[model samples]
Target: MPTHYVYLGLGSNVEREIHIDMALSMLEEHIDPLRRSPIYESASIDPRQSPFYNLVVGGSTDLSLAELNAWIKDIELLHGRTSSTQRFIPLDIDILLFDDLAGLHEGIELPRAEILDRAFVLYPLQQLAPHLKHPGLGISFAELWRQLQPGPQLSSVRYPFGVSSFALTVQAGRFPLPGDPCQLAAI
Candidate 1:
């Protein structure tokens, strides 16, 4: 089996920590040598009641794009996520990149458009794979991150659970949530 490098974006607002931890655990089980960016707390994109915890995970997988998509969907549903539920998102996961693949495949847009537009997505992705080129844009993720306009407020959070390969550090100081100006570039 051939392995392809894959990056996944994860976020949660409801029981933020618990949901993110759950997703990470599931991903670790499915993907090997998982590399995760430090967790970040950001305001929800949609006007919502709670803030969200966001991060990006990268690893190598032998599964095809469609298989991986289905696997992630199943993990979300297993964690109580449903398309019909709107008010609170328990967990949300998106495929950000798949070995430089472009165009549409398995009903997903390659190098997810959000990566170019959202600070939450771009920052963590750059943290994990700065030199990797965006399949559609042909620019490195780090450069794309530098070019994005102001986006949602994001603050680094000390994720409690430890994945063996990742180091978790707690930053001292309370970051004001939402409506406060916090940019990853400054961190």
Candidate 2:
């Protein structure tokens, strides 16, 4: 079986921390040796809801795109996510990018548009794969991040469960931290 590189975006507002950890656990069980980006907390796009915590996780999988996507959606459902419950999401997982494939497949768009339109998605993606080129745009994530205007909503914070070592590079000053960056040395 050939493995394809996959990047997934995770977010939650209700039971934010716990849900994120649960999702990570599920990912580890499903995708070995997951590489994660540092967690980013941001105000909900929906003003009425609580703030959301977001991050990206990457891994190589032998599963087909549709199969992997369905598996992730199942994981979210297992964690209490429901399309019927719009106000609070216990776990939200999105297939952000899949092996440089473009166009629509299995009813999901490749290189999800949100990756460029939303800061919550882009920031963590840039952190995880800075040099990766957008299949559609053909520009590096790091360059896309640089061209984007900074927003006040997203900030780097330490999660109690900790992040992957690759995420730690941010603390070493490789990337500029958002507002009030966490003092990682103390953690």
Candidate 3:
């Protein structure tokens, strides 16, 4: 069984595709059986700023929540993530969920706030985990997305790299059933 089942939100507007790809590679080093949502493009906080490429990844981690946060912060710094006043954020990774534990742990909140408020996070997350209830809200992600007021339009991006290889059924709480093969990415 997986030790720490989690979901993460990733975004970038600085060399968006390359940064996202690089971040995904680093994340795979610590999170196994990673599954990702299709890329989504949404306008940045300011319409004049470069649009952002965003997606969500789900997987299991062997590290505790605090250890994972430290690793994630390291990834951002290594990627040259910088102030976005000029829209030059190389990469940004946020911990959206860590198992089902709610409230705060190690000064980090579970089921990140963005999951409920940001379309970039919510859309991709629902694709990867539509039925999994929010650890705090107790409502399915699918339902939360439905309740959301219209926000920035999120269009799919045809990112030709990175693979989303985990099974959606895993989010539904069933994995590796008899004769069920692991999900494979196309391209």
Query: Relative to the true structure, how large is the alpha-carbon lDDT of every model?
Result: 0.82, 0.84, 0.83
Task: Please write out the lDDT profile of model 2 over residues 69-137, one tens digit for every residue.
Answer: 889889988988879458998899999999999999889899899888789998889988999999999
lDDT of 2 at 104: 92
**Which has the better TM-score: candidate 1, or candidate 3?**
1
Compared with the true structure, what per-residue lDDT tens digits does model 1 show for residues 1-187?
Answer: 7888899999888888889987888898768989999888888776755888899999999988988999999988988889845768899899998988898887888979899899889999999889988888789999998899999889878556442112211132445455644333212
Q: Show how many residue pairs clash in every candidate, following the order shown.
A: 0, 0, 0
Q: How far out, in Å, is residue 3 in model 3?
A: 1.0
| All candidates: CA RMSD (Å) | 6.7, 5.7, 7.9
Q: How many clashing residue pairs are found in candidate 3?
A: 0
Candidate No. with top lDDT: 2
lDDT of 2: 0.84
By lDDT rank, best first, the candidates go 2, 3, 1
lDDT of 1 at 159: 54
